[model samples]
Target: MSSKSINISEEAYERLNSWKKSNDESFTDVIIRVLPQKRNLSEILECLEPIDEETAEEMKKAIDDEDSA
Candidate 1:
């Protein structure tokens, strides 16, 4: 496969280097591993478990107090 040259800032290079799983890992691999995957809102919502009523009320009260402040 042919590879193309791309330019990146020193800071960006350093950040990508830091994400390398090992010295043998390539920049392409690091990018693939670190990048976020696209997910639908329903998929994201499905991951969340429902909280109990008491805990829910406490959280609501905390928000109300923060809003009042």
Candidate 2:
């Protein structure tokens, strides 16, 4: 595999370094572990906080209006 050089802020480097599991762990490994994983619609919805009835109705209305366009 080939490696490329990139510059990051000192703060960013420090943040990534802090996530390293061990001295053997690479920056790439830390990044992959920290990044968000893809989820299905149901899985995504399950993660959301419950909204009030008014907010739910507003969201439904907005979605309906967009669909009708």
Best candidate (score: TM-score): 1
The positional error of residue 60 in candidate 1, measured at the CA in angstroms, is: 6.7
* Model 2: how far residue 61 lies from native, Å: 22
Kindly report the root-mean-square deviation of model 1 from the true structure over all alpha carbons: 3.7
lDDT by residue for model 2 (1-69), tens: 787799999999999999999999999888878998888999999999999999999999999999999
**Highest lDDT, which number?**
1
Clashing pairs for model 1 are none
lDDT of 1: 0.94
Quick one: how many clashes does candidate 2 have? 0
lDDT of 1 by residue, 1-68 (tens): 78889999999999999999899999998887889789999999999999999999999999999999
For model 2, what is the C-alpha lDDT against the true structure?
Answer: 0.94
